[model samples]
Target: MLNIALFGPPGAGKGTQSKMLIEKYNLAYISTGDILRGEIAEGTELGLQAKDIIKRGGLVPDEIIVQIMEERIQTDTEVNGFLFDGFPRTTVQAYILEGLLLKMNTKLDCMLSLEVPTDQLRNRLLDRAKKENRSDDTEEVISVRLKEYDTKTAPVANFYKEKEIYHGIDGLGGIDQIFERLTSVVDQTLQKSWINLVLLGPPGSGKGTQGRKLAEQFNLEYISTGHLMRQEIKKDTEMGQSAKTYMEKGDIVPDEIAIRLIERQIRKHPDANGFIFKGFPRTIVQAYILDGLLRKLGSVVTSSINLDVSTLESIKRLTYRGKTEGKRLYDDTDIIIHRLEQFEKRSIKVSNYYSKQDKFEIVNGLGSEEDVFKRLTDVVNKSFKKIR
Candidate 1:
């Protein structure tokens, strides 16, 4: 997900620009002042605390602010990204935000600084005062506010600049023109964050279960070849018709057909942070096809993780599932064993393929769902760090 910290002087049109960015990019707008005032208005415990502090002419401590920010972030789970405005006003707060995002298994993608001349800012604020009759927009008040912004907020830009994710945009000209400039920088930054992953394992290894969780945790598109083929067949499309012919004959679909299905899924999510390919590339040929497709897309497989479940465990899980679910025809003992053998043969070859590229990982899948997920996430986190 895209996480942006927007920086600007008082009259650099941050409010207008952030709203446009939110609408265009599906980002959740987060302004610290709005969050704090919302807390006070709600009369919750944190609100009461913040109210009392404000009443006593005291600044809320960083810990309290962090708590509020964390709570706000947790409550919003469906956003594409977060647009942080009027936050991290100090260098210390910038570090705090960094730690907070890292704790959430993500990081700030960039800081977009809107640059406006001081005279232009004064004229804009004065024009706004005339239009809205805002008493706070007086000459002296605007000077103090701008000076305070320079003192407190300017250094935070340096913090991001050091990391090389800072993009300075000219906050002049028409609103649409300015937005175009912002989008140009934002689009490039988001592209860098896109990553593709492959999840490999035999049946009953929980790769499908874990793949869904990974997709949610990392804001990725989850693509399972089996699921994609089923969807295609359900839709009765051309590829579906061809796939149906092979399935009716109990034959595997051609690699080209499977590759087309994978390609279709990838194209469906042009703006996704990445994809988790679950149970695709079942053969070495398919693996090469996938690599070629990704190369065409200007991305590479970040990792091919095998969820290593023991043979006994895989058999037991399949047996239990067959008895309990009574729907998996292939879960019959003989068929299950045959399938596992085939999977083992293919998995080892594909694992070796990725190993040669230094992008293979083995995660222990014999544990509680949460435990296995934690191991998977650990591997994913390490891979993401290497990419960034």
Candidate 2:
């Protein structure tokens, strides 16, 4: 569900955008002022009390507003999600709303703030008053309302900002342009909400093919240790030279050296939505080192997906691949089997480590490419939903 708060001062076109969003995302619109007006028009008991307060020039109590929201939410159970507008006016109200949503077993996905200049807001309000014949929108009242919003409502933005879900949209553009920007932010936020995953498989298990495809489909960074090492070797960095020496000697690269290279790659793409880790963390030690590095960056591996393929199938695929590419490593059946054995021995401990955390999934690797991809995608989607 894509729940959001549409926030802005008066005359910021939130109403216009909210309608569009409701249509596009199938969200239930919750506007306090509209609800209050409807209740008054129907002459409900709560509305009578609110009308009396308005007649006496007194603001309605927060408790009454909260009660109204409780009733509304209880009755609106068919929405895909919600678009909240004009209710949380203070930090206190924001907290109350969050608590209410938590009790309801849902939460706000983000707060979308439409940023418009004060001068433009004032002009828009005055123009609205003339067209809509709203007496409360007079310049004097607008000034007082804007001042009140600055004092009371503006801090709600900070409340969401501290929660790391505040998205500010430039509200000084054409309707379509502003909507496009909002859509982009929403899409990016949804993509970034997914958990990072590591793809684990023996040689010829199709990890490279699936990892790259998943990265492109989900807008994730594809981190292939082999690719990174080859690039470093090409560049001839100190670490690359060390790894090259090991490769030339037909020896495995040291864990510490591999960890450093992987760490550098992660830091280089600090703002990536997340990453599809391919062909790294082949051992328990490397897995622990990777965890430490990710922890330093405020993240952790969310899952390790292992492709389960039979030894015979792996051998057949690698031999064919070697013939096509003229690669000596894959051409030797004995060497390929040895590599697979080593991978299985080391990867069993690593798999157990993640399995203890309930983050290990073994996907079948014997099928057509599209069939295998669909199975992988289903697992990934479920993981993404669980993380959110």
Candidate 3:
């Protein structure tokens, strides 16, 4: 579901744009103020309780508002998604809403904040009061409300921003122009929600072929550690020189050096829909470091696809490629066996780490390219469905 939170101070035209969004997206609208007023008009029990609080010049409690929202969400069942309006007024309420949505097996896809000047907001509210005859919208009341928003409600935007799902929309334009901006943000968020994956395999297990296919098919960035390392060496950066020294000695590059290179590449694509990590995180330590990096970005490795191929099959394939392409690394059978042994030792621990998180899947690599590609895509699509 494409759940969204519409955020703005008073008189930012959220009500106008929300109606257009509902028409375009078939979203279920949930405005706490609207619901409370309806309940009061019907003289329901909760409404009476709220009215009594108002009569005593007190605000309704947060618990009451949460309960009302929970009830509303449970009863609504015929919408494509939800547009939250005039709810989650505080940071605490924002966290509460997250828990509620999680229990329902959904989450907010994005939070759209409308940015408008304070003077414009005030003028708009005064004009609205004249048209709607709302005594409560006086200039004094609007000032207090805006002040309260700055103090309490603005933090809610920060909460979503930390999750990388907050989008600030310019709320100063014609209605259609503003709507177009809001829709573009939503579209980008949906695109970025695709699951990022890592592909793990030994030498000659077809990781390159399948990774490229999956990235192209799903519109994800394809990241290869070997490719990145070679690029770094060509650039002759400090870390690249360190890696080159190890390569000159016929030694594997240290995990720290490889991870730094990969991290740099990952940072370059901050707005990618997702990434296919090819030939990376080959050891348990690298896997942990990768997790930390993703957490800092408000993301996680959706799954790790391990391609399983026999040692003999890998050696044969590499030997054939070496003869055809004149590559020395793959020409020696003894070196190929040693590399396979090293891979088995480190990869088992890495696989166990992801297995505990239920994010590991193994596919047979001794097959036609089409067959292997199909298996890889199946796991990816399944992971996407679980997260959604």
Candidate 4:
């Protein structure tokens, strides 16, 4: 599949529409703005110069921008076609981008331009400005901004049109309409895009049930770590023996050994974001090690959801699940009581571990799975709130 270049104005909802297209179709979002910033940080000669100009809230020079673009596209793995959200506003940048793609033997598949009316743009910008409390957004600045965009960007639209690679979608419709059109165009253009997102939850807390629902809804791969552990115990590998040692003694496996076991499983499924760590990392020490392992692999838990189920409620759910499953992992009442005691003592200090670092959520895990899910969804939405 070829990479996509999404072109649209400031208030045209390019980000909102692009997110729908990406999630629905599985697209890698490649923003030149992100590349430009990263380039400057590496002090790659060109980045050093752009750093000064951009630090003052001014635009970087065109050559430096294109140079940054050239480096980024060459290195990116196309797990899905890229959606270029903020890029190629000028014809020169577009021309330079074509050369870079040609050198890599890749071509931009489609250029999607969001078309919104001038009046709507004005209202949207003003309302956003007021809500955001931006001092620079006056009627005068907004008017000038629109005019400058027209002068600089209209040429790039015409250029893509001449190449017959541009598709225009209405940006003023109801969100669903805009999103539906965006998805249709992207599916028609690319061969691959979606990815598996797994959520790890403990017994009776609803990870398995809700994860299945989310996977089916998004068409993603689903794998449970607890299931994996059970399978390994069934087979009895070296690490499995290590885990079995603790389980047989009614003790949680220590972090150092448990992490290596988790790492082996992780190496097998590199494409999936990660194994949903349902029961691992129950302590601050484990979370610390997991952080290093994830960093080495170049990703992090997209979010860590703490289902804040009351001690009594958690015990009830766990007890019922253990009895029904009859698996050793769930079958121990003494262990469950011990774990909950550990949870309460560490509650205060645990927040400091995640408060400033991890994408953590403390969802009220007090009620039914359905009730907890409503809250879980809210945390998921907030954590990825910017995805749309």
Candidate 5:
């Protein structure tokens, strides 16, 4: 996903542009005003504190600002990415946000600074006050807000510039004109096609959620060894019985047998928009075999997505899945913990193996299913784009 941050002084058109871009791109729209009001209405403790501060015209604390943003980032909804209308106002806030995104294995893709002259801004505020009947836009108050903006926000824009992802949009024009400038940047990004998408994370991090979203959105199909096996067992097929027998033995099924099952399923279906593989090639050797199979079939594992979760969390999620899905055979806590230990080591090798090939796009499974899935979608877009 291409995560875009819109940073500028109040009345510099971030709000106007954010709405337009969000609608056009199907991205999440986040503004300070919106978040603060939502939190206050929800009556979260943080919201209550922010409400009190806003009631007195006091600047909300940095910690509170981060707290709200942290929650917003947790939603992995259907977004091309996200638009941050007001955030990271200070250099310190920028660093804090960077750390938060880094944990999710996402980073600042681009930052836009809308530059408008002080005189025009003042006039805009005065006009807004009369038209909207907003009491906060008096001459003295508007001047104070502008000054606070200068002191608190300008440096963060400079920080993004240093990172070389900052783009300045002219805010002097009318809203249509400014929005056109922003859309040009986004259009260029989308015109670049993506060929391969690698989803990376641990179990229960919603790798599947994201994979399915991409498949649906981009007209792709997804493959999962586990899902395939279950369908076979559901049909009471011979191969399903054979596989189930080996699984019950607490032994890894032979690669030839597993691969043959997969090939037969693919031949039977024979049609897909694109394909995402899940829960196969658990080891390095399996990776080689799968790659060989895809090659023979006139394709390859274009991307390998690994869902990351803590060992403890993976166990909980797997056990939960087992209980809910009647797959209790693998739900034993001791078995899961044991598998997790091996997974920790083997997954690293799997990830590094791809990283060495520069095909890995690691994502954070730290948030709710919605949040991580959103991030995963963007990564899929970016990966296919990089190669295509």
Candidate 6:
């Protein structure tokens, strides 16, 4: 997902540029002032706290603002990305936002700062005050606002600057010209941001364990096909119903259905740095289809890892797991052997497809879990190094 924080002082034309970028990029506008007003209007708990603070002529605390911002983000899950305006007013808030986004498996792609001369900003605000006849936009009020931005907001630039995601757009040009600069920077930032990985291995090869670990380490969304299908079925979505019909008849869900579900999950997290795909593309045809799907999204598989474990070792692990865990359905010795045999028959072809693209690796999955995880991380780090 493409997430940006728009930074500028008053009268730097942030509102004007924000409108154009929102339409062009399909981003959800997340303005802190709008959220606060909505909360107050709805009389929610946070709203009451904010209202009380306003009644006492006090600035709302940053922690409260962050709490409300997270609530908004959690509730509004359908979007290509987010445009953050007027929230991170301090260096502390910038760090908080980074942690918050990391927790959500996404990261702010950039902070587009509109840089304008003091005289120009003052002149623009004065002209705006005259045109709109806004009493609050008086010279004195604008001065205070600009001072607050300088003292409290301007330092946010340094925070993003250190992260190398800060871009400064000259706020002195024509509206269209400034917008072109913003989009150019945005396009370049997006090109270098995504990290898609697919995990391929047999049932007892620790795909789930390693996939989850890598996703958290790198801030990527983890897509487990079995879990995704179960979630859809629980929600009774149309796609889920269709898959259910096939599954009830002891049939494999068609590749079209699986691909559609995977695409839906991918689009749900437009702000995600990338995805860790587990258990989806089981066939050579499915691998081809997955590649096409990611291509449509302007991404490709960064790496496809096969966790190499012997058949006897896999049997031993599954048997021990069956006695201790008892959660997986395919843990029976006979079913485990059958599943491994089928995977060996079909998934090797899928692995070869990725290998031909020079994006395939085999990590030894023997020994202790920690040892295996180290081997997996080595391959992953190498893949992501090339991506970055």
The total of clashing pairs for model 1 equals: 0
lDDT of 5 by residue, 1-388 (tens): 5567887776787777888887877678877778999999999999999999989999898889888888887774445567777776678878987777644434556788888998888998899899999987799999999999888776887898787778887887778988888888666644432233445555555666677777777776666676777677679788778777756544456687679776876676555544666666777887777666654553544566666667667767887887785564555767666656656667777777666554676666777767877777777766655323
Taking all chains together, each candidate's TM-score versus the true structure is 0.57, 0.52, 0.57, 0.46, 0.53, 0.56
Predicted candidate 2 versus true structure: per-residue lDDT over 232-322, tens digit per residue? 7889898788887765443457987877777777778767888899978888888887777765564667678999999889899988887
Q: Cα-based RMSD of the predictions, in order?
A: 14.6, 9.5, 8.0, 13.1, 14.6, 17.0
| Best lDDT among the predictions, by candidate number | 1
Question: What's model 6's TM-score?
Answer: 0.56
- The list of candidate 2 runs beyond 4 A from truth reads 133-136, 195-388
lDDT of 6 by residue, 1-388 (tens): 6789998888888999999988887788889899999999999999999999999999988878889999988776555678998668788888888777755545787899899998889888889889998777878887888887888865788888887888988888899999999999988886676788999988788888888988998889999886777667779998778776654443346897788779888889988989999986888888878877876665667789998988888888888998985545456677777777778888989998877656789999888878988888889887765434
Error of 3 at 110 (Å): 3.3
The backbone clash count of each candidate, in order, is 0, 0, 0, 3, 18, 3
> In model 3, what lDDT does residue 132 have?
97
lDDT of 3 by residue, 28-106 (tens): 8999898888778899888888889988999988877887888888777666568998668888888888877755545
Query: Candidate 6: lDDT of 112?
Result: 92
- The CA lDDT of each predicted structure is 0.83, 0.81, 0.81, 0.66, 0.71, 0.82
Better of 1 and 2 by TM-score: 1
Greater TM-score among 2 and 6 belongs to 6
Q: Which portions of model 4 miss their true places by more than 4 Å?
A: 41-44, 54-59, 190-388
Model 6 bad stretches (over 4 Å)? 200-388
lDDT of prediction 5? 0.71
Indicate the worst ten consecutive residues by lDDT in candidate 4.
Answer: 191-200
Clashing pairs in 4: 26-193, 26-194, 309-365
